[model samples]
Target: MFGRTKEPPAAAQPAEPSAAQPGQGKGRPTPTRAEREAANRRPLVPTDRRAASASSKEALRAERRRVQQGRINGEEKYLALRDRGPVKRFVRDVVDSRRNLGEYFLPFVLVLLLVQLAVSSSGNNVLFLASYALLYVGLIAVVVDSLLLRRKVRRLVAAKFGDEALFRTGVVGYAVMRALQLRRSRIPKPQVTRGQKVA
Candidate 1:
């Protein structure tokens, strides 16, 4: 039996358009899922190396500043343990609302120290005694003011919050410390102005 000669190998052909849209000529075919995804994808890394580095540094600095400001503002998550809660908020309000002699204690003591130095140099016994007495009185006044402020703040906290809030939280200590700080320098900055009623 004679075998049929093998047909010449067919040439590779380009992909043809589907019959559904045969009006088109030499047009690209609809993309497969992989092709579509590849087309839509973008590089996160910048093509310009130096520009990328500079932008990343600036972004990091800005983020750090934002976090610092958040801590300064007493935002809940960013706040220190001592600065958290409505109790501390109320304490800050009470301290901010009232005037305290303790705030002037440091400057007053500095002044007295200078006076003592000058008086000792001049050997004025009477002036030295007067200055010493005055300094002692100022110190006593500051201590008394701080104690009274602590009591008042604790009472207010208990009354507004509960008896459970009155003890063992170091709230009184916190208030006393804040009372001694200059008004402008208190951390979290005073939300209530002087002479304003504590809300």
Candidate 2:
């Protein structure tokens, strides 16, 4: 060997691949700004019982109200199982479009309650009996109306969705409850007026 020291061998360099081909390197679409922000956030899982309970209750109430107002999608994380389709919408439309004696039941009950308060203060037996009789009659009428509407709803749901059992998921009872609610207090506010013929 001469006086010169042997030089170290050069390392092999990896060749960078060419830019991704049309479909080759587009693995996943870029995440949205919101998605990125959310990804970066560490959610505060409240450990305090009262704080957690309050947060949960508020969330539930807000979501329930949203669903009741028909502002939520069927696929939404918080949507109620009962509010999950056009079927319920159709049912609501049918119920809202028709004239239902049951709709007045709540207001009538309120009146009866006031009357009872008055009768209690008076201590009048005959008047109390008359008021009670009226309340009973009103309740019976509401019940009969609910039953009739239940049958009609089944028929209509069958006609529209092609199966009587299409409304089998407590829809009849739901319709009954909805019918009994005060009109102004009903959620997803009525689109059709009383006596309006449903097309």
Candidate 3:
């Protein structure tokens, strides 16, 4: 026949894509919602509650110790909230650089008390009058000294930091407290010493 021969049949082809071979995945069914929820669930309280509490307390104690040591070493970062600031620091230095009469007030008062008690027991009217006069004089001196210190500190703070520093809450009280404390008992122990000028 003059017509061309018919074409051969095409090779057979798969109707759908082949399945995945071995080792292709986790090889397990996906977890259901309930299974996932159960897996994630936890007890409201820890299994070892006492141990947990003890550990927490120990950690808190360690933190407090660290802060205490840091403060003793005069580390600014660990200072008490009220004592941490340049204004407070400057005021502290000012107070430390001078000897305030208020610093001796406690000891002076204790002495007067002892003297008065002794005099009262002896029934000495003259000595009793002297003690009262001395107590009044000492009180007056301390008040005068404290007033002078407050004025000086305010002036210095305003000069160094700015006038705005004068308005800082509790700054004046902070200086006065520091001035009243025995030098040895002051916290963040005085950086500047007596007669040592603070710039």
Candidate 4:
């Protein structure tokens, strides 16, 4: 005899739900086609690194202005220098000498280089070595001359234009120089008012 197999009755089975239920699961509200299309069509805001830099710079500038204003308005302590008489004259002389050197230092280096080149031909290795040595010397001279010139300018401004005016001039000069360098210009002209004479 074969083993008996049993099956569940059809009347006892649970009925499956139809697909036409309203507000059912997995049917949450999604964006409308027009809303999605409009969102996609919206203009994108540009994000420039330069703009961020500019904003940071503006904040820094405002902070500096506040600090500078405090410094200007605050009472300052000073040491009496009644005996500092001949020292001023000596300092002025030194500044004048440095300014004169600044005016002529580059030209002097160029002339020296030309003379050295004229005396020795490119075929000579000694001449080449000398030329390089002169070039290095010229570079050092330029650095020194620039520092001296800046010092001289500071002294002149301090003597003639007062501290605040000197500071303004220095800031303007620095900005102009930076701009010119960025543009790869040879030299930046001094920012002077019309009818103002420069020494």
Which candidate should be chosen as best, given TM-score against the real structure?
Answer: 3
Query: Cα miss at 143, model 1 (Å)?
Result: 1.3
Can you write out model 4's per-residue Cα lDDT over 46-141, one digit (the tens) per residue?
477688779989999998776555433321222123212333222323332322333444566677778677757646777767777876776677
The lowest-lDDT stretch of 10 consecutive residues in candidate 2 is: 70-79
lDDT of candidate model 3 versus the reference: 0.89
| lDDT scores of the candidates, listed in order | 0.87, 0.76, 0.89, 0.49
Show where candidate 4 strays beyond 4 Å.
1-99, 112-122, 171-199
* Best-to-worst TM-score order: 3, 1, 2, 4
TM-score of each: 0.69, 0.59, 0.72, 0.31
Candidate with top lDDT is 3
State each model's C-alpha RMSD to the native. Answer: 8.1, 9.8, 6.2, 20.5
Alpha-carbon error at 73 in model 4, in Å? 39
Give one digit per residue, the lDDT tens place, for model 3 in 25-89: 99689999999999999989999999989999999999999988788767899998888888888
lDDT of 2 by residue, 60-133 (tens): 99977776545423343444667446667677777888778887877787898898889989998888888889
Model 3 reaches what TM-score against the true structure?
Answer: 0.72
